[model samples]
Target: MLTPSKVLDLYFLEARCMLIEVAATLDRFDRAVDSDTNGDGGDDRIEKLYESLQVLSSKSETPDRSEQLLKLFSGPA
Candidate 1:
């Protein structure tokens, strides 16, 4: 059985991880956009970026336990 503090800790860890994942996803999309604008190999990098952006958007909008986590973390910030 997990204690309340342990569960809270896990929630925070998960939220931070999710934020990191979102940042990395955005970075990847940015790189793909730059490559598509510059790549001459007809690699359709822009298409890949659009796909990634869609996924990232969905992830950002997904509702999970993170909303509560953020509220708890933002103690009067």
Candidate 2:
């Protein structure tokens, strides 16, 4: 049986997982853009991605949600 708290926790966890996935993808893109050559223009895209990741990292800092992923993996809190 799923209690209300458990349900909420599950929802939160799911949301966190999605956010982490997004962050990871963005980070990868940013890293890949490192080799781009365009008179600093390409740097703008990487910078934007880094900023987005920073926001995601901050959002994933709640009590039960304070992890790299929403609770999808057994990792540090």
**TM-score of predicted model 1?**
0.40
In TM-score terms, which candidate is top?
1
- Off-target runs (Cα >4 Å) in candidate 2 are 1-7, 37-77
- State the lDDT of candidate 1 residue by residue for 1-77, as single tens digits: 87989988779789679768867976877776668865544456445545544554565545554454445345486
Model 2 Cα lDDT, one tens digit per residue, 26-70: 776667667567634354545555554555557444544334333
Against the reference, the lDDT scores of all candidates come to 0.61, 0.61
Candidate 2: residue pairs that collide:
none
The stretch of ten residues in a row with the least summed lDDT in candidate 2 is 65-74
Separate clash counts for every candidate: 0, 0
For model 2, what is the error of residue 74's alpha carbon versus the real structure, in angstroms, after optimal superposition? Answer: 36
Per-prediction TM-score, please?
0.40, 0.38
